[model samples]
Target chain A: MHKIWAVVRREFVERVRTKWFWVSAILGPVLFAGIIVFQIVQSMGGAVRNVAVVDSTTDKLGPKVIEALDASGSFRATLAAAGPGVIDSLSNLVESKQLNGFLIITDDLVQTGRAEYQASNLGMQTIESLQRTLGKLVVKARLEQRGVNPGVVDWAQIRIALDQKKISHGKAVSDSATQSFFMAYFMAILLFMAILLYGVNVMSSVLEEKTTRIIEVLVSSIRPFQLMLGKILGAGSVSFFQFVIWGVSARVLLSLRGPIARALGADPASVQTMVLPHIPAATLAVFIAFFLGGFLLYSAMFAAVGAMSSNEQEARQAQQPVTYLLMVSYLSILGLTNDPSSTFARTLSLVPFTTPIATPVRWTAGSMPTWELAASLVILAIGIVAVTWVYRVGILMTGKRPTVKELVRWVRTA
Target chain B: MPEPVVVDRVTKRFSGHTAVENGAGKTTTLRMIMDIYEPDAGSIRLFDQVGGGRIHSARIGYLPEERGLYPRMRVLDVLVFLAEAKGVSRRAARVKALEWLERLGLADWRLRKVSDLSKGMQQKVQFISTILHDPDLVILDEPFSGLDPVNSQVLRDTVVDYRHRGKTVLFSTHIMEHAEKLCDRLCIIARGKKLIDGTLAEVKHTHGGKHVIVEFDGTQGNARQIFADRQLVAKLQDFGQQAELELATGADAQEILKALVNSGARLARFELASPSLHKIFVDLVGPEAATAAASGARGANGGANA
Candidate 1:
């Protein structure tokens, strides 16, 4: 036990002293916060567009179209002068960068309901907004011409947006659909990144020791399994340390959203109302459980891969199967997020290889059944036990890459 | 004291082939003594300890043939950590490590990363780590490898010092000179089997008479014919002006020298050979086995000497 602690302490102290550790720790949260800030600013507004309207209708609706576009506050519209020269002038305006685009409203727009808006470059969202503005103005003009009361039409318009609520045991859960989805995605990604980064770290450290021949000196005083476990736990601790910093930073940044919005000349209450999901205690527990269990399970396999190879190049090639396993689990997130309650998702969640990420995703999405979660955890525990046993025996092996048959034989004999 | 280390009919095979004589089994044997690998059939006893019980790691220091220290780690930290791993208290280990560093002339480099040090200095640090816990028995496999002459002499003195302090030391080396100069009792292994085991004198005596070297001013063809025709010369190697002859059992070197003179050979040099460990190794394991072992041929288990 003391030997194990010595190994652990050595690994942790040696790695923590490296500049990479501190750099990544600080950069992870800062980058995450930067992305959130950029998103908020993007949602606030975009650059206004200048456009020309060519109305060929008998009703002379060019002024009305310009008025409607101007009221949207995103477009500066002007009525084109009559004649073929109008198009040439508008094209020249676009070439001179004075106008972004020109919209051509044909005389048959009421019958055909089709118009062309041409621009040098346009984002889909901007184009959609322009289409909706013109659509509403055309309908309003037609209604006014047909003798409909403008006040009655305005009163009849509705703004309907669904309020999504999740319930458990006849009590409403305090999570919106968007919040739940993002929360599940965030947890899955966090766990995935942590496991892969740290698992590879453990494997390469083992490889480093092996190639440098320190492992021979180490195994003399301690069991190879103890060395392996010490390294895994040591790297795990570093990852956990970084994760806590990011978590705290995230919480602090989220709490400051109201102040951030007020600084940006927006209402604080509206920003405050967009609070992060209230993740239940059970969900958080599941997240922690899967994170640890999955990390241990995969790290053991990676350590075995490291032990079988004599150098880093060989280890990288030997690590392919394990890397592929991790990639498959990560990619299953797409299927999982699409429909967490689907039988396919449940099956994936039950598989030991994929369970770590898949199960937590389903749990946070409010779709994972309790028995299924328990069963998946049980399977994952068994996998951890089996992989660790392999690691213990495999680390003693040196020289040459073992064939798959030989590897399986070792597992059986061990 | 029950002989610090004893191997009785120990056998190990990796990938169904013998890996003993040429480094692979040397490491395996030492690891077995360290309890890293349990023998399949034979028993190994270390420091009089019983087989099924644990040996205190502090009482054993091993320098493996394939040696390495953490290159990114400081020399002092590496030594202290290894000492602490063997159950030494941190403070005591630190002091002992400092003393070792000073003794090895590496005190000035104590804080430098191992990779920043020269290979010889790094080797000394590795050596220091092995003995830091002050084990009763020190096992070193190929300890002189990758060492310059100065550091090699230092290691030789250190080993001699350990023996003077009443510690049992067992080391393996392919270079016969190290074993010849240092070991009081030596064991020669070939292809996973012990070929011969005894004191240096005893091993030479049991193997038989010494080999003789004779240099003379003579025609090369004539010298070859003279040696080839003689019954006393069991094996003869002609190197231009010199010829080395292995005398047959019970054959007298004086008789051969007289015969060479009578054959009209102008003698430049003639001497009765002192038996060397290399000659003994070649005689015991056979010249073919020695050559194969030298060339690193795998899975060759020829005849055993004992």
Candidate 2:
């Protein structure tokens, strides 16, 4: 055990001292902050578009449309009389960048609910908002024409906001669907990237020893199994440390969202809508359990790949199968998150290869039975044990990369 | 006293390949004694313990034929880590590592990365790591294959120093002179078989008989006819000015001396002596096998120097 600890300390200290570790660790939080700042800036909106309402209707509906568009605060609208030269003039204005777009309102708009919008270029959000405002005006105008009170029509058109809440243990929690989905997505990506990145790190470390011929000296002193286990645990600790840094920084950033938003000249309330989801203790436990389990499971296979390969180019080529296995689990994440209770999702969550990322994502996206998580962990543990056996034999092997048949033989014989 | 190690008829095969085809089984046998590889047919006993596994790892120091160290690691740190892995305490390992570094003229390079040092320096560092924990037994495979004369002498002295301290040192080398100069006991293995093994004196006594060293005037060409008399000489290793001859069965060494003088070759010295290890090795393994081993050693030295 003490010898194993020595190997662990050497692996950890050697890796942690590299500049690559700190750069990548800090890069994660910097990327997160960049995304947050971008979203806030987007929500504050761009310069209002200058557009004209072209009226060809006999009832002068263009004025009302212009008034509604102006009130929406996304467009600065002007009333223009429809004439033969009116469109040509607006086209020149749009071409010269003086006009963002122009909406043409005609008698056919009320009849067919169709209108032509012309512009040099317009954002999707701008077009959608314009359509909503025009639709509402047409509906109200039609209601008044039917002798319905304008006040009643306006009152009936008030938007009703839907409140989303998730129920846990027979209590409805105030976690919005968007918030829950965002959290699940975030956690899945974090787990996937961390596992893949650090698992490859383990592989390179093993390859470094093998190519450098250091394994001979090492195995003479300690058991190969001890050396392998020490390496996995050491690298796992580095990934865990990185995750903690990212998590704490994320929390700190989320709490400072108000100040950051205000500094960007965005409404603080708009930023507040993006609250950090409240993660239960059980969910956090599952996250950590799956992270560690997945890290061990994949890193063992990676270490074996490193051991079997005799050089860097060979290692890169040999690690593809293991990489593809992790990718399959990651690719299934979107499907699992969408329907966490589906048979496909449940089966994937139970399989050891996919369980590490799948189970945690399913738990966060939907309600998962406690028994399923436990069973998944058990299966993952078995996977790790089996891979570790392969790793033990592989680390001492040199020369040609082994085929899958050889790898199986190693597991059985070792 | 119990033997430190006994590799009893050990056999290890890699798939369909014979382990000893290229003389690589020397390293393989050492690896088995270290428990890095398990023997299929026989057992290895370390310090009189059967099936001891790696329990004796801390007691046995091994320097593999393929020399390497962690390139990114500091010189002192790599030594300390290796010693610690051998079950030495960190504090004691550090002190010993420092002392060894200072003794090896590497005290100023203790903090430098292994890759930054010269090949000879790296080799010295590896040698230090091997015996850093002060093991009871030190096994080195081809330890002097890649060292410059200066570093080689330093290592040779350190190996001899270990012997003076009453530590057991078993090392293999393709250079017969190295083995001849340093070994108390010798084992010659070839073609997956032990050709001979015993104390140096015993090996010499058993394998030595009717050997004659003749130094004469003129080149070997001048005495070719005298050596070509197979009736008198069984084998001849011509060294230009001197030749070592093994007498044919019942031929008598005095007969060869008379034949040489009769041929008008001026003989400066003629003496009978036990066969040198190089002569014995060439005779036992044949000229071809001996040349192969020597060339392999040269290739390794060239690679290291390059």
Candidate 3:
């Protein structure tokens, strides 16, 4: 245990002090800060303007169109010299400051049963509002022509808002759901990058020793299992420490940006007592377990792969399959966030290859089952054990790639 | 204070190939000495405890052929860690690591990263890691490869120092010179077979037995004939100008010189050569384990071997 700890300490210090650790660590938060502000500014941006119209519809729809649009006050359409549907010549009219957008009704509008809408979507929102107003006018006109009363029409097509509310089982994903959503992903992506790279660190280290024939010297004192565990744990701790610091820094930044409530898109006005998502102690425990399981599972494979090669290049090439597995887990997490409880999502959260990221994601989203969480953890535990077995086989491999048949033979017979 | 180690036919086999196929490969093989290896095939006796597992806790120090040191770890920390792993008390390990560093002229590197050190310096750290616990037997396999002449000399001096402290040092190296200089006795093997094991002189005399090579420089136009006339000459060869003859039991240098000078020949150079390790290698291990391994497959040959 002490030996393992010694190894872990060295690994953690080495990784944390590296420039790459910080570069990746800060990249997520900076991008988050920049993106949130960018989005918020963009979402709130728009011009308050009125849209004009020149309907030349043969339906002969009158002031009912004007009255319906007037009630909304969002659009001000006028009867103009130019006739029906979209005003195709608005380039000239808009240039002359006649309108922000226009609809021109064609003479065959009723017969054709289609209307044309056009506008500069950029530099104004006038066209969008006008489109909505035009849609309403067309509907009302059709209803009235069929002798339908406007009151009954409004009642039949009444707008109902289904305000959704959920009780969070855990804290980490609650106050920071928006933050958690982005954060869990950020944490996961960073972890993916770190694990993939750090795992290769362990691999490259092993390969270097093997190539130089230093592995013999090392193995005499420490068992092969110890060496593998030491390296994987060490590098994993480094990756973990890096994210913890980054996560804390991000939370600080989030709070400084007004409040996490505002940051996560909770209505800024409705947020009287702003509370960030609470990272429950239980969730933290789960994360630690997942992180350890994930790092070890991958690190062991890397060590095993590294043992197969006598040089860094081959080790790197050998580690590719595992790196790809990490990538798959990352993509799966994205899928999970799309709908954390979905069948595909839940399955990914259970497999050893994808569970590290997927499980934590579903856990945060309050979408995973207790049984599923335990099962995933158990599978990951088993995965780590398998990593050790493979690593031992990899190191003793005498200058040959361990094919499936060879591996089975070595495991079963050796 | 502990009794010497004893290894009894300890054989380590991987897949079907065996490394360290027998206890005779180790000099600690004195019956009272304990051999350290896994129980399946080998037996070891260390002090009153006799077992077939790896050397117990901290009694023996080992420097495997592959140097194992954390690259990023401080030189002191690595030595101390290795020392502690060998079961030294914490304070003692620290004290010893520092003492070894100072003795090796590396005290200034106490806090420096092992990776930043020169290869030889890193090798020093490994050496300290092995001997810091001060065990009776130090099992080193090619522990001196990366060292410069000075460091090698330092390591050799340290080994000598360890011996003076009554500690036994048993290490393997393809460089026969290190073995010849360091090992009081050794066992030479080739292709998983022990060809010779004894004092240097005895082994040389046993397999590549010592032979007398007398070189007499002269106008040797009739060198072959001159040697032929002398029945006391066991064998004769000429290297362009100088004629070298192997003396049979009855022939001595004085008598051969007396015969040469009486025949009106003046000797330019005359000397005797002893059998070297290179000759023993060619004769015993059959050219491969010694020659090929020393030069080419410099791979795992020195390691994973008895």
Candidate 4:
């Protein structure tokens, strides 16, 4: 045990001292904050477009269209009298960047519901806003023509919203669908990144020792199994440390969102709409358990891959199967999150390979049966033991990477 | 006290390849003693243990034939970590590591990464790491294979020092001169079989026949004629001013000396002594094996010598 601790200390201290660890650890939260800040800035609003409304219809609809577009606040609209040279001049204005765009209301606009928008570049948001304004005006004008009151039409246009709620423990919870989806996605990605990153770290560490021929000296002093275990635990601790840093920083960033938004010239209330989903203690526990189990299972297999490979290039080529396994589990996360109680999600949650990621996502996205979660944990534990057996045997055997048949043979015989 | 190690008919096979087919397993034997590889047949005892179940690694320091350390790690840290793995306390290991580093003339390089040092310096650091914890029995496989004469002499002196301190040092080398100079007891292996093993004197007396050394004043022309008599001299290795001869079975050494004197050869010196370890090794393993061993030593020493 002391030998194992020594190995663990060496692995941990050496890695933690490297620039890569700290850079990546801090980069995660920085990138995440950058995304959040970008979202907030985008929601605050974009630059208003300066455009003109050309009147070509027998009835003057240009001024009314200008009034509606100007009221929307996204476009600065000015009225222009329609003439043969009007469009050519507007096109030249757009070409020279003097004007953003122009909307032409033709005589057939009301009858044929047709209009032409000309711009150098048309943004989706600008188009959607313009469509909404024109549609409303056409409805209001039509209603007035049919002898209906304009006040009634305005009253009827008030928007209605549907409040989303999740049911938990036989009661309706106040969590929104968007919040639940985000929380599930965040947990799945966090678990997946932690397991894959730290697991590969273990593999590269093993490969370093093997290629350096340090394993001979190490195995002479301590058991190979102990050495591998120490490495896995050490790398796992570093990953967990990074996770703690990211989690705390995320929390701090989320709590300070209002001040940050205000500092960035965005309305604090717009940022406040991004309320985090409330994670229960039980769900957090499940996430941690699955993370650890998944890390162990994958790391042991990666260690075996490292052991069987003679060099870095060989190890990289050999690790594809293990990496693909993790990728398959990760790709299934979206499906599991969408329908956590579906048969596909439930089956994947029970399989040890996918259970670590799948089960946690399932539990967070929907109500999972306690027995299913227990069974998944138990099977994952068994998978860890089996992979550890392969790791113990493979770490000492150096040569070409073993085939799948040979790996199975080692597991069976060892 | 029991012997440091005893191997009783131990054999090890790796898949289709036989690592130790017969008794010629030198490195394989050391690995079994260290419990790095288990024996397929027979058993091994270390430090008087009944079976090679668990090795008392703290008591045994091993330097593998393939010499390497964590290249990116500091010399001091690598030594300390290895010592701690062998059950030494970190504080004690650190102090001992520094002492060894200084003794090996690597005190200034203790903080430098292993890769930053030259190959010879890295080798010295590896040597220090091997015995840093002060094990009772130190096993070195081809320890002097890649060392310069200066470094080799330093390591040789250290091995002798270890003996004076009552520690058992078992090292393997294909260079017969190193084995002849440093070893009290010697074992020669060939093709996974032990050709001979005993004290230096006993092996000489049993396998080495009558041997004579003659130093002549003149060049080889006169000596070659006298040594050309195959019936008198079984084998002759002629040097410019000196020559060593192995007498034929039942041949008298006095007769050869008389013949040299009568042939008008100026004799500087003549004496009869036990055969050298190199001669015995060549005689036992044959000329081909001797040439192969010599070339292997030269190749391994080429890096340091250059």
By summed lDDT, the worst window of 10 consecutive residues in model 4 chain B runs over B295-304
Model 3: which docking level applies?
Answer: acceptable
Candidate 3's C-alpha runs over 4 A off are: A47-118, A122-137, A159-194, A197-201, A259-292, A324-378, A396-398, B1-4, B12-20, B23-40, B44-135, B143-147, B174-177, B200-254, B260-306
Encode model 3's per-residue lDDT on A1-414: one tens digit a residue: 665565566567666777888897888688777865654444432233445556666565535556666676565666655534334566567766666655556654444446555555444345456556666666666687799998887786767965434455543222434655775786686667777667777887677667655454345455667778888878777766766876787677655554544656644543233455557677788787887778778878788888887666676677778888888888776678778889998788778888888888888777677898999999888777776777775674447677878766655542
Return whichever of 3 and 4 wins on DockQ: 4
Best by TM-score: 2
DockQ of each: 0.46, 0.62, 0.25, 0.52
- 1 versus 3: better lDDT goes to: 1
lDDT of 4 by residue, A82-149 (tens): 88899999999999988899998986677767888998889998899999999898888778878899
Quality class of the docking in candidate 2, CAPRI style: medium
Which 10 consecutive positions of candidate 2 chain A have the poorest summed lDDT? Answer: A270-279
Sorted on TM-score, highest at the top, how do the candidates line up?
Answer: 2, 4, 1, 3
Instruction: Order candidates by lDDT, high to low.
Output: 2, 4, 1, 3
Whole-model lDDT, candidate 3? 0.64
Alpha carbon deviation, residue B288, candidate 3 (Å): 8.3
Winner by lDDT:
2
Chain A TM-scores, candidates in order: 0.84, 0.86, 0.69, 0.86
Q: Cα lDDT of all candidates, in order?
A: 0.76, 0.82, 0.64, 0.81
Runs off by more than 4 Å, candidate 4: A25-102, A106-110, A119-121, A136-178, A195-198, A244-270, A338-347, A367-371, B21-23, B50-55, B219-231, B234-243, B291-306
**Model 2: how far residue B142 lies from native, Å:** 0.9
TM-score of each: 0.82, 0.88, 0.74, 0.86
Residue B209, model 3: lDDT of: 27
